[model samples]
Target: MTRRLLALSILLCPLLAACSLEPLINHQVVDYFEANDIASNQVILQNILRAKDGAPLHFSELASIRGSLSNGASVSTTFPFMAPDHATTLPRKLGTVGMTITSSPSFDIDSLDTQDFTNGVMRPITPETAQFFLNEGIDYRMVLLLLVSGLRSGGRPEMLLNAPNSSRVVCYHELPALNALPTQYSILEADEPCDGQSEPEFYAFLRTINHLGRLYPLSVPQPPKPVGRPFDLDMTKALTAVASIDPGRYSLARLASGQYQLMSAAHGSYVILCRETPDGPAVAGVLTSERDESTPVPVDACSRKHGNAADQHASGDPAGAAQPMMMIGEQKNTVVFKLRSTLEVIQYVGQILALQQDETEANPQLPERCVTLEYENYKGGNMTCNFGVLFHLQRAGPAFSSPLNAVSYNGVSWSLPAPKVCRAPTRCDHTLETISVISLLLNQNKSSKDIAKTQAVQVVP
Candidate 1:
């Protein structure tokens, strides 16, 4: 019996040793295989999440991937795996973790109660609040999620749940599910993947507004006007001023009945004939010519000629022909003056006709005035003069007859109009009018429905 037991023990010892050795060898092999696989895949995953320079992938790129996965959009990508000594190889397949992105129901921002939020414990979501969350190391994506949730949930205030104990915050969308369970749903990190069963969906609405606010942190939405329709224009109380004159440089002067002159440099003068209207003042007519008097010759030449003739007349002449000569000279001067004055009137008329013909179409608001002057000298000397329109003025004030002043050529004296006051009780603000004009122009290109939709979606801070 002792000999039989010893023989059995000897057989059992070999079997036990074989069992232990087999398990040890298998574990070492499995560990080595897993370590190599992880090393290769780590490079691929890092490349997918970040660029070679370490910057995180852009949202658009990530969105494109998400869209392709959801919509089955054809996507082909190659990830290079780096090996020792700059050797590279492509990864056959990458393992994917389960992720689900679902859309939540739409809600109106206006319906939110902005005054009472978070049971009056915390303030509503604002730029300041958003910044506070960012400073606390909250990712922009999570911050946006909270803000959008608050905006959708009637401006409810958001708080960090289990913050002191755990750095996680409860998502409003998961509140209904969390309430039913003993455990609370919380976000552990900004980039924490959504667990389809536990976390389910991520709220993604108002994406454009969220992106704009987050990326351009300095930009804030402006509050809409308290009263008055956008781009409203009341022509009755609209500000009016002479169009052709620059209010900054020239002053308006009432030269005659129904005729107003902008006193500036003689070359820079503007003439406007205004008629009182229910809409302030309307320009009845505009003066197209400069106030100028022409002599037979240049003014200096005429003066010199007159002085010479006077001196000759005063000098004693033996023949009485000197008197006839003086008389002839006087006649010549009179004829030259008459001719010059007639030519000036003709030139003025021609300028008005040219302006009416749209010769200055190149510049619509301020047209170029072309004037030609022909001076005929009785002494067989003639000259031609050409000039362009000078004054370029923009409207300045609400009152049409407001005192507009202009600098003289000497820059010392100013041409001023009679004291005129605006009797209209209400006048359009120039700044507001400008904005209205631009808004009107932009709205003209959009349909009424489109305009309404845009206004509804506009976010005002």
Candidate 2:
């Protein structure tokens, strides 16, 4: 009986080795990825197998078996010792294994269009393209998942991928390079601005690719919905108010009721008050000389034609030459300019303040109903007069309030409910004018540096 059993074991050994060869090969591949700390590669292999065969083979399951075998706790480890003849049989079976592997498929990496995987530029991967990568032994599914994660995470793939050129495969070799780079992927967090890309636009593009369902088999998670603003203020009035003032000379704040508050750029300067009147929302304040004494006002030739005191003075008219005087008390107490409509204010202020002196020369007629000032004289007597009496506040034309449409000025479109202020009132410590000046200086400096760098590069050649 013992001789018969030994003879039977010899015959059955080769068959048993053949049966165990496939699992051993799979275990070795899983061990290689895990030992090398290549989790991405391991995932790719599992995914490929899952795609080819309907069975889901997890690396963790293989890892657990490997752990048991290494600790001498698994019964399968003794199979090799029980049948030494199986080892001789394995060498002959390798050819069959190689044939099976080669028969799976070979991918043409060179055939893939270089443009499809370029960083920053999003393009859909065709089903054929994905299959080609898979055939090349590239885990295209893993590649797609990592790509979507990097993009959604807000990391610039250009920075991460570091391909030699736009037209190149973002390879498995390149995947390890990301570990050295900063993990941040969101465009918003990047110091350099992306071409006005928002998070929503990026996710929308991802969703488009996901719907194609060729690159990645699984569905990508949807991005969170953006929060909406609670209220929309009439930005026309605020924007008009801001544009009318010399940019650095004034600051604006939106009130809770959607009205705006204007204040002088000077620290501790009182708010430029606005009142709701029967005429409309009118600004109640006095236009006082910034200086205590009269200074040499630079009046242009066109302004002199307006016959205002400042213009006369500049043109050598004796009456104009007489130093423009103001009541000491009334100097501090200016007039109320009524708000007709936010758009109309710009036209009204432009004419009344001689901002459009050229237009004043063409048709010089002061409006009868221009801005009015009401204040007490030096003798403490109440008085009221048009701002035109003191300064050349010319009228442009009929009020612009009639045909209400969008107002475009200085390259900004001021819509009815003003676009939300870029900075909240509490955060806007610096006057808009000051911020504009700083921004201009910074931009000019950047432009100068860029020019200098370009010149240097050219000169080096």
Candidate 3:
């Protein structure tokens, strides 16, 4: 009976070791995760490049991954204490155990040519997503440029202020008498006394919208409180009042009189551009940063936090140009801009890539291009380009290349420029930061049938 019990225990050792294979294969699992992430980024870059070339856009997903793993286990029983302790029940040393886990994982990648993919990509963004980004303190300019498809307001085509003898623009034309905003993605910058050379249509529009953050501030509230009547909402009209106007986003209330009322469910939400002050009490107050037009503006990046009380004290247009009232009040304000679809964003980014490439080729050794503002009243130019700084996807020869962010397409490596700080893996690069936000938008627009990736790991014995 004693011998039988000892033999049973020895056999159990092998089974126990086999069941604990998980701890040994953790590295392999992480490898798979990283691979998928890199692939997703590459696909996005490829589409953007295609957009620049006027080629067809395509998408592919790593649908599923299956791994066939082989496990090898060896258990060798030794004497209880070598040759001298063989007779004793307690051995001087334990038996040797070892294991080797090898896996050949096969991934099933499917091209996104299906109608479902097209429909999902073409779907417009909702107000909720925009609101979420605003509340998160994302730059107002970045949000508007990426999401807004078209603006509905009265303004002159934006004008670019230029240096005295040079053609490059130094700032935006904020003089109401000199400029009004364009209603759509502009083909050219507003011709001014300065050099009239405009950037690509999209970049010009990008810079045009950059000024919108300073010229127009907004607040998105659950039960919106309008300051005045730039727009009106009612059963007869679709304009946004202090209520929900779109029936698709929120179910309109049906009155007892059997008429559809322009209203929302208790929790329904919507967007408001130039409606009210983005921060602080909605009453009388100027944003801490509002300034005079005599200062030159930094035209590159308008990345100041949109509505943070802490950041309020450190305010001025990146370009030192003058700004209009931050909040709307029965003014000729741009009420709303149509939000773009996922497909449109991809195309937008692609066009941007083309512009950047043109710039780099023109000055290969160009030490980070700086957008400037040459105000007529200001003596020196405010040279800054956070907008361009955030988007430096180095041409053919990648800048700040790493295995994590690099992609080999057509035998050339491509990657985003590195971030100045490296405190964490997330939010390390502006390129990655923008891409992740867009990716989140894509996820929000997914169809119900979209099978989100699974976290389960299967092992066949």
Candidate 4:
């Protein structure tokens, strides 16, 4: 009886170990990335198993990896989940433990172009290609996953997968070595800018990858803020207004996660503010640098162009240079002049003191319209700077009933709301006068060193 019991116990030990994942890990590629995070565990496992490793394997490695996780804490960093509606408490789960197995047939890779292969479905895995990965003990699933991931996300496989390039895989690899990428696989493709529309497919793809990486993915917010939206500049009586805050820093793709700081400024202008944020792998923002305008402006003189005043053409004729204002009041105040001379200049100035006066005396809801001033050189080097006042008349309320006051121009407070508007110019005209208003308010006495320090926004190393 004692011998019989001992035999039964010994038999069960092998079965239990076989049912677990501990033994096969080192023999498989998933272990390498598991040695990397929890969310990626399943993806890594699937990809490794599907790669070129030539062998039939057991199922124990999968279960063992899953069992090893301690509430989202694998061998990697701890995932701390925040609780909802509460600040001090913690959530039950900090990270996700995926139930899907990499070897599971349900996994679908849509990015691969299989129609070109011999069977018209799946490509044959040759021993030569398999040998490279097999030597590293990578499975077919992992091999295919890596290939697909690389292809979809602008990797080497993308080139070969494209037409005309499909016939030359070896030749592609023969090119020069690049930053850890084969020259064939490392071309950086440009992406089209978002056109303020919903991008469901892209959003899903990114989310899937993030989930594979074990990260909590966030969707882009609506009305995607421009990377470098300019502030309104009204310089009538006295300039007074709050500068817009920086749109957070964006992390470029291919970099690891961490805080990245950047500076924002007017394009081809000056950097007026500095902002810092943790840029993720896909966000983009402005650097505190100026773009060269030595090249001619790209807009054709024939097509009417539009944007802020800074983008205006060199032509100074008011009729040819006139651009539609963003608001009715701004349009009403705008004055255009036909150029008779060689130069044309338009300047917008406003003050906060007038706004305060108007708010106190008249209608409080309506602020003064932007001040429009234009100057043109006709003949004999003659130039005149004309000015006008704009008033909004829509307010009929009892609490506010005065005409719009002049804006305060002194730099007393940077927090005031001093909004201004200017339409960008279009077309090239040799006879058109040019608008060139130097910002007198800009600190001209500042040393070049000081200006450089402000623009670069870098710590002296």
Candidate 5:
């Protein structure tokens, strides 16, 4: 028996020696990190819930987590070489083999529930930030509809076309005429009707964000970085400089042979998406036909040069003139559009949630602003819905879908459906991408990844 026990210990020594806990420890740490991410998403959703319930929004952040794991193994064996030949009590063998593992994890949490943090989150987003997100490749509709409060024409904030109820229906057929209307049209004589409420135009704006975005994207047209010193630039200089490049492009000066060369610069704000014509370059209202696919000409400025119908034009103000038009505002000028802050945007989502919850199958308090969306009952049809439709939260039964994000609030689970499973509010898998993108947007920072790197756990291998 003594020899057997010694042999068993010897045999187990190699097994114990080959087992290194580093990989296991690393995996534990990574799991902890993923837990924090999951919790963070829950926090974002919970705050959105607060907004929905009209409760003031609050936030908390996981500062860090420290975890330790301890492992122990035991082995034992016993055998009676032979049953007791004469013993009344059996000499049958009993052996034990056992292993034990234990873990303890600690967390450091921080609260952003303070006044300063709340204020920062609630502060209006700047034009620079709006432009930055646009550059980030967020869907143009998301950028415009969520962040933008409304158009700023003639220095007045006009939310002439903003309405939707979690239902993201768009009127693609109507966008061209909608985009063609001057920015000042909201303030001007109002030919197309600016009653501060128009269902068709709202859906039109939401429907065709792709071309509409290109036709009327936000711009912070910075003056070209001077190669040397700045020079007084005129309308003619702007036009002449860009002459050699293309009609729908901007102009800049490049150093050449000890002199500045006038040429078209790709960095222009408004571009006239035009189609070639025998009569001349007619201004295209929007990218509608195959002919409208012509290379868009960049318009440097909206200068008045009335003459032949050869000049290109763009999507706003006095839309056409003999020279290329900047086409930014009510009077053919650029203006700083407004963007909502993080808190405000979340509040809007809350409002939509509250509305969706309160709305009924019988009465259905949906506004006329959702007219275009009402055309939805058809499948295998054109895409009339907006990204919001892709962002769905279920008050019940999210567990079945394996929700992408979910949280326990007031003893109930609120979940945004896994894009992989519950495709859209329609509860079918269409595309499984945008809901994750929603999380990405919420976690956006002026510098997100860099800040994450600074916060990363330093694992010295």
Candidate 6:
């Protein structure tokens, strides 16, 4: 009797488990083969599935193997391996069909919680307003379904009412399944009427919106850098006016009105380096080669012309212009946190002199300082601030290019020792903006292999 019961149990197991076959089949259908070997398996699975459960067969499988091609479509095989064949189901081109979808930049599509639709005003979900998803063109049926979903949530009634007429609606007579399934659906055509715009025009607007949204998501916000307090130093009383300037720098931030205010004070640079922290600023150490004061810079007509003009321009100004074509001295000062780690270096000796020539042309009253802050490396608990460096030229000068000195972070003020003078500081002027990019190859702790392979070479006479 026990042996007979064991045989019955074994026989009934497959029958009892057949009710939950989808999960079992799903697991069993997967084959661990190389990517190149998937085509034959796909064809085999298509046949097996069709025979087992009357599933629809995709055109590509039916065409070569079964000699059953789509009636109105042409198939073009680009590769031996797996590739999707494109097909059109339109019976006749009625003028031109067009559609589009759009969304607000502040709206989060993935997490469409109650808050997103809480406002009384329903944001348009048309192609003109869609910005969340990456794809620009969605099927007309998909557009209608999404609008229906929005309406079901009591979000936008108007959007649902005009779903058929949306600019990006794509009309299709018949739609096939994704993986050779027999499922079919129809798309709303673009000939439908909108209140003011034609179907094609509406579609073009939606297409533009979709393009903008893909390039710039609606939900993501512009990253705001940490705010650094304004610099306050008694430059007139405590600091000596005759002190030598080791490193030349500046920073700027935009106000609500879209105008950038500059901060030129040393304390501003310090605050930018140590944003929000009680500690003032990080020490920046200047890297320079040993040199005496007697070492003279090269003399050229180009450097002399603009270099002299820069000094003349700075005669009455608070901070003087950099000498033209001259290599400036280097110093190491601590940079605790200046906003972003990278600084942008512009190749504009000419633009600088032009700006000096017409200060009014480029905002006459430029701020002497600016600050930027950035958060980076956000993997759970690991985060760091990236300080940006921006440089603007005081005036246009000669086209002389050479390597500038390097700096590091020390405990005290930017420790810039052995300040190397340029050939002409006035002719080759520069100022740092709020967004500066720095080179990491010069980092002290980088690997030797990295230094040897990707390091930048310094240019010095």
RMSD values for the candidates in order, in angstroms, are: 41.4, 35.0, 12.9, 36.4, 11.2, 35.1
| Candidates 1 and 6, the one with greater TM-score | 6
Tell me the RMSD of model 5 versus the true structure.
11.2
C-alpha RMSD between model 1 and the true structure:
41.4
TM-score of each: 0.14, 0.14, 0.59, 0.14, 0.54, 0.15
What is the model-wide C-alpha lDDT for candidate 6?
Answer: 0.23
Candidate with top TM-score is 3
Give the Cα-based TM-score of candidate 3 against the true structure. 0.59
The lDDT values for all models are 0.26, 0.26, 0.47, 0.23, 0.45, 0.23
lDDT tens digits, residues 276-299, model 2? Answer: 335543222211112222112212
Best by lDDT: 3
Off by over 4 Å in 6: 5-121, 124-461
Q: Which stretches of candidate 5 lie over 4 Å from their true place?
A: 1-18, 71-101, 114-116, 126-138, 153-221, 224-298, 301-327, 332-336, 358-390, 398-404, 421-438, 445-461
The better-scoring model by lDDT among 1 and 3 is: 3
Question: What is the clash tally of candidate 6?
Answer: 104
Q: What is candidate 1's CA lDDT for residue 231?
A: 38
Model 1 misplaced regions, further than 4 Å:
1-119, 135-138, 142-199, 202-216, 229-461
Clashes of each: 10, 14, 16, 56, 4, 104
